[model samples]
Target: MSSKSEERREHTCISCGINISGTSAAKFDCPECGTLIYRCSKCRKQSNLYECPDCGFTGP
Candidate 1:
């Protein structure tokens, strides 16, 4: 089971740096480094690119 803190932790969209806490954000692991990445719905729809912080891998 997840702890309360873990459940309440907010993630920022990598493309726009917005809080993705209550939005329909896309969540996936970075292809290069397996780091978790989040993208807001709008950014995802527009295909905004994001770079993985761990491996610096950019993707659409």
Candidate 2:
């Protein structure tokens, strides 16, 4: 089983492609595929576009 740290390492901001392990990132389910999506505070503030890696769904 993977530890919490390992799982955190796997999460990245979909908008910036940056590792969000230690940041106050936002996590949510993709509206199209229900897959988990992460966005860093910076990107979220800028209204950056994010595409769901699983379903190819894009959103602001």
Candidate 3:
């Protein structure tokens, strides 16, 4: 298994305005702003939260 340090991935959320850590190595980019959103484990019942399916809006 990989070490703890290696397992942790750093990333930032665009819409939520939160610093996400311990994310997966694989991440998704915002369709609208093209902002990178790493897979945040802290996110509740959501992973790689994407913008609206219809419209590519980042924020509310």
Put the candidates in lDDT order, highest first. Answer: 1, 2, 3
Q: After superposition, how far is residue 31 of candidate 2 from its true place, in Å?
A: 0.6
Give the number of the best model, judged by lDDT: 1
Reference-based TM-score of each model = 0.91, 0.81, 0.32
What TM-score does model 2 achieve against the real structure?
Answer: 0.81
- Candidate 3 per-residue lDDT over residues 1-60, each given as its tens digit: 868776564556543546666444336655676655453444434543546434566432
> Which regions of candidate 3 are displaced past 4 Å?
1-9, 13-22, 44-56
TM accuracy, model 1: 0.91
Per-residue lDDT tens digits of candidate 2, residues 1-60?
A: 969776656678999999888789998999998998999999999999998889899999
RMSD of 2: 2.2
State the number of backbone clashes in model 2: 0
Q: Among all windows of ten consecutive residues in candidate 2, which has the lowest summed lDDT?
A: 2-11
Candidate 1: worst 10 consecutive residues by lDDT?
24-33
Any residue pairs clashing in model 2, and if so which?
A: none
What RMSD, rounded to one decimal, does every model reach?
1.1, 2.2, 7.4
- Which is the winner by TM-score between candidate 1 and candidate 2? 1
